[model samples]
Target: MGVEVLTVSSKGQIVLPVKMRRTIGITDGDKLAAFASDDGVIMLKVVKVPTVQDFKVRLDEAKDWAESVGYKEEDISDIIKSVRLAKRENSN
Candidate 1:
């Protein structure tokens, strides 16, 4: 794609060209993460924020997999503590 100049409106918003938007697969209501660098570079990235339902679905899937693998809920704390201890020892 060639370079396309964009003009910012008085409201400090720039309209992404339809062609560019289509190429990048950006749609309405999508969230964008914007970053500005010291070198005057600006970037926008599409980011997904999981909804409560999405998180619940993922949690349910994880629970189902853990149950299928015979992992009980009581093992989580020990597993996390062991991982943290291992990480602390490795960092030292």
Candidate 2:
């Protein structure tokens, strides 16, 4: 683990140290997901936003796997309905 003390600017922006950025390959304009814990600790993670093509590729793979497992279209639809009903019941 590496630790570096950083000072927040007037606009509440803190420059990530060059060493840390180089280590993590964080370039300028990269999207970062920030989270704050109950203990006042902040964590930043590099966000890899998935494109529509990515979703389509994953869905195709899932469909192929399901077909190989002998699941038909109606079977998939029934599974989805069952899951949605279970979710509604749990939420209530």
Candidate 3:
């Protein structure tokens, strides 16, 4: 891991050093998840938001798997409710 000192601008923006950005594969227009702690520690993580096409692809895969496993459409609601009830009981 490498450390680089950064100064936050008045508008709450900070420029990541070129070396750090290159190492982490960060480019212009990339999204980052920022986390701040009560102790003043801050962390940044690269995040990718899925497009609608991506979500549809995943949904299709899930539907295919459900069909192959013999899970009918009518069974999903009962399965979800039972799972939620079990979780609530366990948490208590």
Candidate 2 residues 1-92, lDDT tens each? 34555688999888888889888888988876553334233445446765556555656786799999999876856876777787777679
* Residue pairs with clashing backbones, model 3: none
Candidate 3 deviant stretches above 4 angstroms: 49-92
* Per-prediction TM-score: 0.46, 0.45, 0.46
* Quality of model 1 by C-alpha lDDT: 0.69
lDDT of 3 by residue, 1-92 (tens): 44455798999988899888888888988877553334243344446665556555656787799999999888877876787787777679
Give me the displacement of residue 57 in model 2, in angstroms. Answer: 25
Minimum summed lDDT over a 10-residue window in model 1 is located at: 35-44
Runs in model 1 deviating more than 4 A are 49-92
Worst 10 residues of 2 by lDDT: 35-44
Residue 44, model 1: Cα distance from true site in angstroms:
3.1
